[model samples]
Target: MTPLTVEVTSSTGSDHLLPSKDPWYTAPADFEASIPGTVLRIRTVPGQPTVFSNAAAAYHILYRTTGSRYQPTWAVTSLVIPKKPCVHSGYNALLSYQMAYNTPTIDRGPSYRIFEPPLPNNYGIPPGHQQFDIMLDRGWFVTIPDFEGPRAAFGASVQAGHATLDGIRAVLSLAGHPDIPLPSSADKFKYAMWGYSGGSIASEKAAELQVQYAPELARGFVGAALGGLVSNVGSLYTVTNKTPYMGNLVLILLGVMNEYPEVDTYLRSRLKTEGPQNATAFLKGRDMDSFQAFQTYAGQDIFEYFVGGEADLEACQALRKIKMVEWMLGYHGAPEVPLFVYKAIEDELTPIADTDAHMEHYKRFNVSVLYERNTVGGHISEIVNGQDRAIKWLASVFDSSYDKEGGIKTRDVTVDIYKPPIP
Candidate 1:
């Protein structure tokens, strides 16, 4: 077995090497500002969803965040500050809400959803993410990150982790505006994370990567609430491929390919003409829904389009070399920050068994965690319906007064099986 000649691109240095002309990927004037987890550019977000729209102020933020290569790259996050102080307890406080903006188009980020409120004919902004509006109404400043990074690596952990954590840092660094006077320092804001499904991936990665990637944030982090967790990509690949949901997985793969040229190169060699045709359709910035994509390519087996069929790519050693699987694989280590993991019993994308595996792994360690198992709905249902419970748990974590009797709250993990009313 001679050493495989690994073909890698020089663009691996900084995602900036081959500019895609995306503003988020574009580096700042000061290269030093491009330091991992720092602010690159600051600007006021347009079309502020009216003051009556449950949020006080809206701003778009572009910050320097790390990607999969652990290199300097930039990403964007949307900041929504509440009108009043947090009624719960101390510090102005912050909440990083990861929106499940699952799409191949780079511009279809959470930032666009919040600001682009409904006009006469603009129905593009679905209530899919309005779920976080209650957090803003709670008097907690919320920062929604494009954790998928510049390349929009949806399922890539390191990139999501770096971008997620850096979004928080960027928001904290913002100079105080009169509407919402932010804490001058980090300690002044007690923060927590909340997300479901795709959003949960970013939240969980940020939580796990905090100690290694951003230890400074550990102090400010109170807890993390992740529902509908994505435990494994291998599992994801198994279920979504060539199925209706295959469209969703392909978008994520394109995300990885855009970042890793070698993977793209390998796939290009194996892909038939129809692959590029499908790729063009995906990047069109229109309806990127999986079911919609399913209708379009229903009987047309994508496997047949591959040079040597699906087995060839799966068997390739280079596929495992992508290195992103290391983070996406669950239970890398027990999170130092408090955790709340919940899932719908019959999640469409991530099954409860997967969530159970995660909880069991965390249980191995004596970390205090709040795990909930709801017997209602699928992945999207958990995101929408279980939000109240998730938000309540996060509030308790953020509250300085709410703690175990004079000590850190560490309890044996309790599994609750409640059937939520079907929505």
Candidate 2:
């Protein structure tokens, strides 16, 4: 077998170490390590002092191999809590994850460090909470996978899922680490996952793949929670294409299109004249920096040049070629364990009907699915506000007895109208 290689890329190289200027909690003594024939830590996002009520430490993982012309590149990392219970059947470790999205920051970019702390208002553990310290207090370890595989492996949801699952395996498989306690190799360990919006997309895919891709990990994934998930790309394109939302819509589309070649050709036919070569460049070029402004530059109004005066048939037919939603319906749900799923009632980015349809599908598989609708927050709010509920649910998964706390719920769903079609 080819040996795996690992290294602490962040502490060395051109990586910039952000100061531990957190407002909520102090970070544990930080250090990076790597092992050969495995993975490496490329960058570290330091824990905060006391800003948000609950915060977690995050890490980025990179796959490394020896003698390869292309050096091992940055992969994924997670907010890690040292000294938590190891809970997998074969492995004894816990790693909470942050999902990937097209926005590029937390989405598919390099991993950000997280400082696990307290819930803002949900837990009432006081305003200034330290997640890392508290997890240690509770005898649980926490880590967040960057989920952006090597090279920020963008837009490939399955790849992101596999990477997160592998990251947990790698972390739990570690020989000795100060933050985590050692369980006799004989002890069956456990694990849990939580993510929202783009993060949820990655988490959902991860849960679905854990059983087949990593059967050894089958027994450990006890529970998972995802909110505001992007479960259907075809549906998303149908509603958001050519509208202002289409800009943000295109990034994910392009990413997925890149991952699945048939979709790429479909997009090329609909949007690329002579190979929408520019599409790939544009996708990685713009992060969430100006998502609201992309329509002006490349959306339908400007893209009409390539559509060849036809829109519906070719575009819709081409989209069907990908089968992203049909694929979603086929996904295996949260590993025969307790599951939690929430969707914003007024989500602007993801369609509620799609989310509903997806939940109904999961029911067929007898998967424990909890789909909540938030009455208050919008798309971005789901990302920010959903963290509290996400973490609390994750805590419960890590320790089954910790489920007494109340989680915020949502029900009212509404759809935003699209402006006149651009083409």
Candidate 3:
């Protein structure tokens, strides 16, 4: 069989030469660990452009996870174990950090991003690399999962949640392994989750799905801090459609097309030459920057590009569930774990009103939530503004005997409106 080549601003590395059309990410597997979140393969040897090779014994894991429909799927995660000891109780703390790469490209996840110099250019280093280094500097063990799944289902929360939880599961399951030197009592490690902006989607979804889908895995998690929460996907589509940022429509469409066959058939049936052209652009350039994706389909609306009248499209009706109640958070119910949700009131991408509604919805569940609505920043600005405070909160959560905060917390979800100091 001849190796297929994909075109983009791509380098001639990555062991597999993938096809232009959906490049299949697969490895020869024995499925030795045959559980829901099991490790199929582990790479002890480090890759090029290592991040923390000096202080941490780094490795990557190819783990088995579930898709949106609970189908057997696979994901990759990078695990870093610190050589030094922990700060407080001498037990190494674990943090599952989800970075919001946003694009539906598997090759550009944290497994590729945190490595060397040139790779981060495309794979996207986390906006909170400084914070990550601070955690790493504290001798913390961190697992960065390719939460978008192998096919890169960017906005698929179910897929993201499973991948996030399963990634941590795979790492913890590695305890007592001869080669990987994890703590003898790995369960003692206090687990906390955090993400900002696009990543906040994955982080929050993981929190929401924890008690139900992964009860055992959820037991270890102390708290989740998420900001720039995407409470309503419908508003996102409505706001971006036909506008200059119409590329977001293309991004979401391309992502859903991979996850939902109905979406693919529905969307493709409507488009003429330009429709497939834009979709193809999304597939080939999965590594597209948000702005680049926007520019590709800029100023064009999906309905406007439809071959017939918008009412004639039945696929739009099927896709209706995704934008509104189905995939969106709060509508599903509240997470059992403690939550730190911060959002900028001036956010342009995800409106604060929807976040308010999401917070209120969670409040009904009696979850102990620390809600901070910043008055001073927009989407990008709020990243820096809300991050430090979130880190501070995580420190407090892990410090004392307060690791386990039971029940849908009864107390009022603390809400604060403050002005973030300008950077």
lDDT of each: 0.64, 0.50, 0.68
Local lDDT at 88 for model 2: 29
Candidate 3 accuracy as lDDT: 0.68
- CA error at residue 20 for candidate 3, angstroms: 9.9
| Candidate 2 CA-lDDT value | 0.50
Q: TM-scores of the models, in the given order?
A: 0.81, 0.65, 0.82
Candidate whose lDDT is highest: 3
Per-residue lDDT of model 1, residues 1-423, tens digit only: 100111111122212211144343465576444456566555455545463356766666677787777777788887776777574544776889887666555656666645554322121222543565677767888888878766667657678877888888877665343333466556678888887777787788788888787888777788888878777655666555565556565656566666667777777676655754444543442334343454554444455646677775675565675534533444445677877777767766666676676666666665567767766666655655566778888888777644522212323222333344433
Q: Is candidate 1 or candidate 2 better by TM-score?
A: 1
Q: State candidate 3's TM-score.
A: 0.82
| lDDT (10s digit) by residue, model 2, range 219-321 | 6677777767777755655665565566555455555554456665665655543454344444454344223335333445334434553353245654454
lDDT: worst 10-residue window of model 2: 22-31
TM-score: which candidate is best? 3
